[model samples]
Target chain A: MRRLRLVIPAALALAAALALPAGAPAPAEARVGGRPPPFVLPAAAGGPTSAPFRMGDHLGQRPVAILFWATWCQPCQQELPFYESLYQRYREQGLRVVAISMDSQATIMRAGPNARRLNVTFDVVTDVDTRVTTQLNPRRAAPFSIWVDRAGRIVREQEGFSPAEQNAVAQGIAELVGR
Target chain B: MDLRRERRGAPRRRLAAPALLALVVLGASAARAQSDLSFELPGVGRTTFSLTSTTTLRYRGENYDANRFDDDFGSLYQRFDVALQADELRAEARIDLFVPHTVLVESRCVGRPLGVDDPSCYLDWDLRPERLTLRWEPSEWVVEAGDTQLVLGRGVALAFRKVDLLAVDNALRGGHVRYQGSNFRFGAHGGLANPQNIDPIDLRIVREPQDVVVGGNMAVVAPAPLGVTLGVHALRVGFEDVDSIDGVTRSRFTDRAVDVAGWSAEAAGLADGQLALYFEANGLRRTQRLVDQARSETGRGVYASAQLQLTELTILVEWKDYTNFLVAPETTEANARRIYSAAPPVEYDGPQRLRGIGNQRGGAIRMDYAFLPGPWSFSVNSALYAFNEEPHRDPFEGVLVSHSWMTLAKRQEYGGDLNWSLDLQGGARFETLLHDHDARFRSGDIDRWMIHGRLDITVGSGDHAFDFIVDHRHEREIRGDVAEFQIGGASVTYTFGIPFTLTLSLRWTDYQPGVVVSRGRREYNFLGGEFYPSLEVRWTFEPGTYLSLFAGQTPGGQLCSGGVCRDVPTFEGFQLTFVGRL
Candidate 1:
């Protein structure tokens, strides 16, 4: 009991000290108005040589929309087809949409079939270990999306899919690509 | 005993100081910034610090009539999760505090002489940092110390991580290292198993056992024509036998150890990127050190899956065979979270319960078809399983169980103002247990079957939405007192422009009083209640800030997430929760 009394206060003090500093450039994070952390993940099944998809390569060339989803998530099932349509409509305008499957190793094999069932044309990558997801969506919300403009700045972030927000998501991408 | 008494008396006083300190820090930080804080040091590049806070307050009134307590109690739980990152270096810490130091021991103390003086009747106030970690990642290499999550291929050998919804967090408190290469990758981790000790749902705090574990995996990927990847993994877990007598604790390190070795192979992009396949097999050996002799036991498990995609149809098939291959000791207690490894269950993710994973064999197949040019789809899934007593004697030796389900869904949008979606699903499960010696099933043998259906509809467009859900299940068990029972529930939720949401739900079950016996007294399966009603309100203050309140009764059962399952207890109370991330 005595040890706990001392340890609790010391831990709080240390945390306070860590939060006191200010005035420095922020690191990469997946949030509105922030650049997303760079990641390279293995493309699900069908890509050429199963080559990895790198976020750094598309930063300044195209407006990218990253979707974090899982095959078992019902909302994600509905959202994937909508994103596929958006990808088809905006690909010519330098709009790149990448779907990142957050499925664990046990269910990862379903990613390819699910994507194919939706007939999606965009790149589908696997984050089985969730190394990239921990930095992007720590809450692990399904059907989460982050929109990055060509200037490497996040423009919009949305969690959960709603039919109502479909228009706003499309408009956000349209504006990012200067459509 | 003295410490427990002190904790009971000084909870409020002891909590005041830390509570005040937290508020001060939060106020100061809020005044300076709304989100994460960024700063720089002399030599360390840019640094960012982020904090997330979650607080829960629960008030339990009179519970079920059969198990009512003399007094009502409340508890407050607070958690702070902080992370700091500087270039390639990162640190994380989580602090949890619980107040009042109380436990719900009425159910266990009924009809007995045990009082508050009993150690099991009360809990000690707890405030500590539950997790702390430091990590460095330079280029393709990662080196981490302290607490970390680890997983091997398919999680058949070793898998430990956090499942927040289920309140399961199992971390390794030691060191981990990994290297990521284009064609070759490998990683290794070794540490003592650190499972969460606090039971928020049950309002109890218990000491966690210490188990040492070491594991590693290596994989190689080949490109194109072959399009195959192969990997191998190995794990060893040491269980220390501990005994406490007269307040003195003694531990024996060389008591027992479990070793597992596995290999996996994957073939993808077959038939022109339309087909994918995966297979994994593992063997486990347990050695127990006795006074002068060592006893050993062996087990094995296998899992295989395949996926094929066509122009308008997709099919998936999975199979599993496990014989005495439980990674951790099997525990039936509802509040125990001792699972160290999780293997995929080759069946639909639902409430269906299997006897045990130690001796089970099953397979499942699913097919999905989509109607192009419009948003319409249909899916059907079927699975079969069997549980045996002595798998070593006969691998396939038990009653047959089967489950099948189908769903039809549609989505539509009218202009840009109105949109709606609908999903209808129906499923059934059947099981027949045969007697050990008699070829014909006896009256005592168990025969069970259940049919269930669910309907979900959502209607909304821009700033407003409404969701309706209805579920029904009917089951019949020939060997139980509750031979026939039906469970049904319905719920409606309204989302008011993304800021506020309200939900009202009601559930009922027809299981009689004889099915469940609590404290040597017969009680209804639904905790002596036929109707369970609940109301929930959620307010989103901002993107990462929210408050939610739930009041009324809930009938909890087996809850599964990420292929892991846990049995949660029913609740009849009011809970308020607040979460803020900055």
Candidate 2:
């Protein structure tokens, strides 16, 4: 009887929850205000010797904004200038912008030309196997932004890009960089 | 916000009784503080014992194999997980219960616990304690034991890993310890391998031959503008001898054993964004015991990858060679993250190739053209590898006969992909991959090509959304390697504002034998390939508390995750899964 008492209401609540129609809420980022997720991606050519690099290297040096994007994303292209502007203003403030491309090999090089055209100055690490994306974006969607403070904590995460989202993300970057 | 705190911490106190009792038995220090338990159990019927259950009650309309006399009964399986944490000490445990309506007396077993000799010889329920772990952190030293995964350096040397989707429950029954500092991290682990009870091999790994693995790794992170790091890792495994004969002995038995070890060094650095360069090299040695004596062999492999961002495009080139590089039988390097695994197609070719990775050398090139950074883009990647040594097998039966430990000669695969993704409120993507491969014998000459494509589209507003996916694959193989086969599936998913989701999926398969028995003669079947359909509904009643019900038959095909790939038998029936953490 006691077990029934607990099970009945709980079942009713769950059933009611499940009965709701589709259009689920926006999914949440797993790394918000938490320890940075583990990741390793291919570094771009030149600066450092070619090797597998991870998230720990940026700690204590400066704030880092990891923009997971692909050239094909319209919003990503629109947002590239935003990141460029931010990087330009904050570069001397120890702010680093790393645009990790989730593009196919054929399209990844395209980021190079776009960066030049957009006058975007940032690092573009390539993820071939999608390992890092799998961890950070479980849904496999990109144009996602993650802000990591100098303390190595992932302080903010914004997915996709809307004008409102753009402002919030810019503010998030400003706060993290100022910190 | 306070409710969130309550949910994370409330379950901790309620579930502390039994876990604490177990911890006490393990000599846990009482002075340690406990952390909040944030896991919430999922179920329609809930309880607060910090207990959660995932129940899958399956009903197969028809027995999978008609030749079998025993009826396939409704199977009900429930898995219960428990977790507890105190300050720097933590413990987790999971147990599974299975009850089937009918058990075949003559049948071996479809599902059984780790040590059950006859899981289905008679009708009875089953109880399996699958995993248990206890960890304690004191000051800068961390010690842990029981069912743990270890990743050393680039995983070229050590990575005992598993994937749930692939039905790979492999783990190490041991412990790992790590010491952390401002600029460096190092760790070591030692454990005995756990063989899968339901390995596709169709035979139980009789305990006579178990493998033990031990390894360690260290890494140091450098400062940026150009951040660079270097690391080294190593691991060794000793395989216990296996007795080939069964228990109903009247036969002579030969015990086979091998000792394998690997060492790797990796260097990775980045220049904020200009370019990234990475390189890794691994050396391996193995000793196998023959009928009378033991013989040894040595091999090494190096991997170097570079990404060059030129204007609007990025180009990547990678190279690798691992001839006869062998790890313990239980540690398959197929999972995607391992360095030693290398790219597909370029594998190690060794004299003692069994069922895992070894012996090949090759390089690959990939180019990306997203410079327009538009929704329309594509990539091309090609890889080729050559077997340095061909594994030798007995010509009569084609088995590794008479102590000849040789891996197969290799093959090659090169492919290109076109990718497109769009997001309004929901996300959509379409990708197609075309590739060819060689699956020949020692010469590695036989070849064929295949095409695979997938499209995911989501359309709707915030109130309700519709997600659809269409995918298909066609493969052409050498000889009867696969003849000609095609597979495709479609899924429709509806999501209701943040908490509710329903999905329906259907799949189709077409298989035609391509092999010629006598001379260009083919095998024909009057019956065609079948369709598999399934429906699932999920509800997140509360943060971590939720319920899911699945019905129908999932299609049978390759199930690959984390580089480990395998084929899973189709599952027909219903499953209800509930997870709770608090």
Candidate 3:
């Protein structure tokens, strides 16, 4: 009986809260066919040693692939070598890859070592504060990928990694690079 | 009979009205296709608002054999998160609601004086605004007020943040400011520790202590030629002493204070990014104020690591030492909270509850070599730990432990028609207790071995995939009981394209140290020849949204994430989980 009294009021409050944002205009996010938000973060490994990474500098210069990963995520660990292979294959054809680590302060110290151990040679940066992640991968999914064309527009996005998606991801990159 | 009639009649009517109203409101909102809202404010800037919600509905049809609670009960847990960003300003808030609140049967009510029917065991209903924060960042400066996450100097001094995997989110409710430059960085923060009191999964409410904290850090980087950086940090915390008397909470301010001061130095990008080095050391002072006297104790810690990366080989070595050093230890079981500071544990990321951190020394080394051709790699690691012999103060004193593991992995694709991968790993752990505490006590040495393997095979260009996993552990503990145990599990997952996945898993265990046998009493028993089986189905509605259903039983144990560990309760029920953005 006491539980029922509490549920009724709580349910009504939730309904009211849910309806408050219904009338507002639709907003844009970092998704396919849109321009991704810019970011700057500390470089944990690779690319211009001891320097911070700014996304604007490489936006329109060449085709780019952005990979979001973490040290504790097993899937991320499995998927990194694949991205490393992709970077190695397309580096000479005006392709650039940036791997952003979403490891917090507790585990951020291992990001560099993990990236090194995985044989990743691309630019790796750390989002210790998660400010960039909030704007890009709001759901905090690991092994997320975003492909951008030379014109700085996002062409494709994937939430999780599977061995089956390797060819598709490679094909997307090949198209951007005009292979 | 009259009381029962009133309870069933009035509450049912009240519940139905709001439920109907909610459905109507939700239906009206669902007509829109967008999940986020955006608009421009005059004289201000472009503003955007987004909401994310996760709801879980659970029904327990069967209870554990020794549990006192009856089955056939339902519960709901929901979280609503809202964020707004306008140019350089941002605001965020979150609200959590639970109906007919539930507590962890194993942890909270198994052998305690409270029962499920007791109000002290579970709240009838709960709703709380868990987080609220505002921030402004312009150019090279950031100012945040309300709730904040802060860390200093490799987290040995002070660090507090949200660790979702462990269901631990503790923030500081005050203010913070920082400035970043090309070669210099500075920051400072001060606030009262605001640990989340509600367990999202169990919907249990716990009391939190109000600890006051203040900290700061500064760093300067040398030019390109030097490639070196130096920094310093300091932190102080006043942990309030809290006690419960006759169901009421009380606190004393003049109890204890902890202070840590530290410095760090790092050399990175040396030898053209091939070599990197880091070192940090801290000194701690803890002062206790008694009714008649005040006493103080001193401790210190050091952590260092070195890394070498080359085209085909990578090596990393780490070392850490501490003596009587722990920040804001859980003084009592009732007020269990995450420690304010977390140092790196130089062991494998599993089962850290038994690894002592207050007084210990350890080092680990790992090497990875890509010696084979075409998408194959091998790696090996070894670690050793030793603890001081403090017979009067420590329980697991003079203990020595060692761990070693090796893994081989491969990933291959054949003509874009098929893809496959394999990962095989095996490890062994040994522990020796030097001193004998007593024959009746369960204090002894341990020998354990484990092996894990995973295989993933995908066919037909991202259309279908299958995953198989197997894990086995064998252990022998030489204690008064002299127990020998084994645990094994296997699972298979089938994914149908990009929308759905099905997984079937089974686990068997013969290791039993904490299983209860009698209802309403703490009777010891062994769980021999027990099996737990479960099935799950997941569907993806869109990017950043999903629905999942799970049924059957789960065998829970120690789960570690982000350097924190917690015990999860076993479940025998059906669950539906939904995550959506709007």
Model 3 chain A worst lDDT run, 10 consecutive residues: A24-33
Tens digit per residue, CA lDDT, model 2, B343-458: 23321111112232355455666655543432333445554444422322111111111110111110110011211223221111111111222333433233334555556554
Q: Rank order by TM-score, top first?
A: 1, 3, 2
lDDT of 2: 0.47
Query: Which pairs of residues collide in candidate 3?
Result: none
Runs in model 2 with CA error above 4 Å? Answer: A1-179, B1-53, B61-63, B66-71, B85-87, B102-124, B137-141, B195-209, B220-227, B243-267, B309-312, B330-356, B371-376, B387-446, B511-529, B557-565
Tens digit of per-residue lDDT, candidate 3, span B118-150: 533432344567667787777677788877767
| Per-model root-mean-square deviation over C-alphas | 6.4, 12.7, 6.7
DockQ of every candidate: 0.18, 0.10, 0.20
lDDT of 1 by residue, A148-176 (tens): 78866555455666554455456656777
Could you tell me which 10 consecutive residues in candidate 3 chain B have the lowest summed lDDT? B516-525
The lDDT for every candidate, in the order shown, is 0.67, 0.47, 0.63
Write the number of the candidate with greater lDDT, choosing between 1 and 2. 1
| A-chain TM-score of every model | 0.78, 0.72, 0.78
Which candidate, 1 or 3, has the higher DockQ?
3
Candidate No. with top TM-score: 1
